[model samples]
Target: MEQKTVTYEVQQNVATISLNRPAVKNAINSDMHRELYSAFVQANEDSDVRVIVLTGSGDAFSSGADLKSVATEKLGDIDYGDYLKETYNKLLLYMDTIQKPTVAYINGIAVGAGLSLALACDFRIAEYDAKMGISFLKIGLVPDAGASYYLPRLVGVGKALEMSLGEPISAEEAYRIGLVHKIGQPEEFVQQLLTLPTTAYGLMKNVMASSYEHTLAEVLQMEEEAQTTAGKTKEHTMAVQRFLTK
Candidate 1:
């Protein structure tokens, strides 16, 4: 794809959609939002891509919305809610429905909406030196880009509230609280995800996300339906065959 703010590349079944604004630490702007949505579409449509990775080109994943652009605009004229409705709402919703696993490679600072973007991913692998937090409070803004929904789910309501009122935490702290899957190379997790059954992963993602909001009986029904779908896949059939033969 011919993109400006985001770069798209696929390697070893992993489609890497990198935020390309390294000069400003990959801070997202309107252009970046458009490009990112397109890149994700491209990745989702590609048959070669088993996993999708969101990362940054420089030392940071993203610094969040481009405050420089905001500074230049008339504050009274800006409708923040409209901006989100037009921009990331669709992108984040589409990401939730992605059949492939997604990983956020937090190489450095991921604050504000940038942190929210990372939270949208199924797995987050933060570099050891990365700093992350719900940093919207510093700028007198509430968390957007699905941060408000995802943050509390990962770290519990109490910790999420504390982080909202405080500074960015270290990658180690993030890992300790279940914010990130690990603190190391993103490739390690991506490679492992690629080796898993893609169909099962997608099914599990749907069921697990539903598990949080549904009753036990509802979730059990969801698992029953998902398992029926999974059991029909060639991968599952092959595994069953191999097991019986052994």
Candidate 2:
């Protein structure tokens, strides 16, 4: 079988989605967009997969859009907008909504839509040298693939505005501004990423993301509901009972 543009592999309970065109820094074209969406959906539906990590293979995480595709001007196809909306925008939104935890392992440069994809993840852990940007303005384009929405919320209105106006941010700066959850030495990033506790991370992720769109009262109700549901879960019940007995 041909290795797909986006490759999916499961190790333990983690489903890893790797963007595979390293030769071009994983610049996303239409095929890569489609495959990425499919991979996230497939992982979400797999009960065996409790967490998902999205990464790219190479010295760079992803350089965002493949310039060749834009140069071809094929975005004028009849269903082009809809196709992009579903495959790119909706896919990231779905990944955010999945009850499973999603991690963006930013091993290198992440620009344009690539940065947006990382923002959509529940947590972002990056190598010290990893760089991120909202560089659409530099290319005379507006932000797409959900950057306009995800970026501001992550780094505050003023900073997000500054970045999206087209400057790049380093991994250290990103973490300082709360855009990344953690940073590791480039050589140790992959190993450090696997240290997250899957189940606890998943539960906390669902709660936090849901809070974004919910009213305070609604969030309280949801918190109660989620707590009740979690109380019945094996992990929750066992841990709580064990703690009480101790």
Candidate 3:
């Protein structure tokens, strides 16, 4: 297959999706957008892929939508709003719904839809020096790619509004505000981030996703339900019996 804008590789059970356009800061052009959507769908279908990590090829995660592409394209030929609503929106929606966990390794700048992509992930692990922004306001545009939805929920409505309306924020500040789950020094970030797959982070991901929409009472019920369902699995039973005997 001719993979251009995005690349996918599997290690253990984790599927890593890299945005390959480093020359342009991994900006999301139409090709990259379509490629990412396809890749997510592929990962969802593959039973071998128990977890997914979304990252970029170079230092920057993504610069958001390709403004250069947007500037030259004619709105008359394509109904962009409809196109995005149907396709791009579905990408975030699917990411949220995927049974397996997903993580965003924000190694560098993540802006606009790029930030939304990070937000949509079950967890965001960032390099301490990285920058995150909902920079749509800078270009006189509204947030898309689930920014309008996820931002408010992640950082609360007031904080989300301020961040979207304000300039970009540093990754450290983002961590303090709950936007990012962990911040690691740039040199050690990749190695540090690998621990997430080995930890209880995947279960935490599922818990957080469920907490986002469910009430506290409902959430407790869900936890119990998950416990019961997981308890029946051979993997869970083996681990439980091993611990008991030990």
Candidate 4:
């Protein structure tokens, strides 16, 4: 499918899918959402693709929802929850569980749902100058698009609540509080994603996400299961052989 809001390309087994509406900081609308999902599907299905990197076109990663579009909408008894069910909910779930490791390359400002999208990623690599915000309460809305779920787990409930209720934070503060795993150039991170034993990464990613809800015995069983699966991969066999030789 032709894409206008997102740009997709594959090189060195990496599928880099970028949000392309730099004019407005890549603010998402329905078209962008649909195109973003399609790009993700393409990357996930391609045999040559092992890593997915999501970034923005220009300086800003994303500015969240297109408020102008919302402003233009015929406001009435419009069901916001239903709107999420149709758009962000599905995208977030798919992204959250996309088997392969996904990185949100935060280039600049990310607020509201844009921040939520980053939270959906397995890892977040941010530029030093990037700024992040929840910005929901500022508009009298609460967090959506998986922010509520990922934030508390990411930075703990105290920091999450503070950030959500207060001002936007700098990239340094984000990293200090565990909002981002790394704050540096994203190129090295992308290269590592492309070259790493990502099959094992995918397996571990799923198990890790599921471990949160599973009991210790159940988690042990899952570890056994995931280990068995990972042990069978060609990458694992090669890695073990490489280790033995060294």
Candidate 5:
């Protein structure tokens, strides 16, 4: 089956969903939004897929929305809120709801909604020289696609605001600010991330995502529940047996 705009592949328990529009720096259009959501859903539903990685085909991860597709006449008539509601909002929500761990392997420049896409992932690992930022203000738009929500959570409110208003930062700087988990050569980066235990990682992602909106008591309860579910997994059982033998 031909996958348009995005490519989905599974190898060694990792499902990689790549944005395929290299000519425009993998800019997301309506079609890409649909394809990406489908890719995530596929990975989430596949029991063999342990992790999902999102990246772009070319030098840039993504440059955000395709401006060429936007018509001047339609700009005035466009319902911006409705546009997001139908497209990116749905994709972001679906991504957030996936129980599996998600990683944004930011290979290069990521700006505007592209940054938001990376922020939504449970972890971000970038090429050492990659540039990343929320650049919606440069085009007279506010950050959409969950940037406003995830940015502050990742980098703190003050730093998130500053970065949103400023130019893109290098991957090294992004790591220093905790925007990215790591920066390294592509091969090493992916290898390191894939070493994580998938079932445990997913549960931890759930705990962290919930912690932001939940009270301490509620978060502890959530952790206990998630741990109970995770403890019953085959992986967990095998790991314990291995530890006992060792």
Candidate 6:
């Protein structure tokens, strides 16, 4: 059997999608993208998977785009924009649309598109010493894979531009600047994230994502509708009953 470039595993309602190409720091390649998309789709469809976690195997989360594959293509003959529109954009759109809570467990360095992948997640928990940045400028390119959309929203325009134009920052600085939700030992962070009530977390993530682009009135209405939907969930009903008993 051939090894998968991306591996998906579900345990106790948590679905983990791991980038398996540790030899090249699990860089994003065409095959990995296909595998990742499939894995995410499967996780989203699985009734038992309440939360989805994305991480990479080995020491690095991902170095960035697979330059090796890029080298194989005829640079001038390829339309990079079309390439991104077909692959990464689809993946990003799927991540955005999924109602399940998604967490990016940045266990090590995440650069360029790797950082963008992390940004796509609703929450990011990185190893304390991990490094992250968008290094597209270094290579005479602009940030892709939704970095342009997510980074500025995450760390603010000034900080986002600075990071894009400069070097990678330590996870500690990333957390301080609001780029990441938390920095801790990977295992501890994963455990804490998994403890969150999945239904509530998903609804909250939807509200937060909507807040970025919606007017206050629109968001309030969305929140009202979401609350109604959430209130119908068995988890919410059970929790409410428990509270009443208490």
- Output the better candidate (1/3) by TM-score: 1
Q: Please, what are the lDDT tens digits per residue for candidate 2 over residues 6-30? A: 8889887778899999999999888
- Model 6 over residues 28-108: C-alpha lDDT tens digits? 999998999999899899888878899999999999899888855587787889989888999999988887778899999
Give lDDT per model, in order: 0.91, 0.80, 0.80, 0.89, 0.87, 0.87
Clash pairs (backbone) in predicted model 1? none
Model 5: ten consecutive residues of lowest lDDT? 184-193
| Root-mean-square deviation of every model | 1.2, 3.1, 3.3, 1.3, 1.7, 1.9
lDDT of 4 at 65: 87
Predicted structure 3, TM vs. truth:
0.85
lDDT of 3 by residue, 1-246 (tens): 357999988776678899999999999887887789888888878877777789998999999888788645575575668868875687877787676667799989999888889888877889887999998888667888899988998889999889988499998899899998888733244445444332244454577677968899988887776667666666666677888999
**Which residue window of length 10 is worst by lDDT in model 6?**
185-194
Candidate 6's C-alpha runs over 4 A off are 1-3, 71-73, 186-197
Question: Residue 61 of model 4: what lDDT?
Answer: 92
Task: Name the regions of candidate 1 deviating beyond 4 angstroms.
Answer: 71-73
Q: Is candidate 2 or candidate 6 better by TM-score?
A: 6
Per-residue error (Å), model 5, residue 59: 1.0
Given candidate 2, what's the lDDT at residue 53? 88
Kindly give the stretch of ten consecutive residues in candidate 2 with the minimal lDDT sum: 185-194
Worst 10 residues of 1 by lDDT: 69-78
Candidate 4 per-residue lDDT, tens place, 1-246, comes to: 698999999998889999999999999998999999999999999989988999999999999988777744566656789989989998987887688778899999999999999999888989999999999899778999999999999999988899888488999999998888899877787778777787788778877888889899998898899899989999999998999999
Q: Give per-residue lDDT, candidate 5, residue 202.
A: 75
Error of 6 at 133 (Å): 1.3
Best candidate according to lDDT? 1
Better of 3 and 4 by TM-score: 4
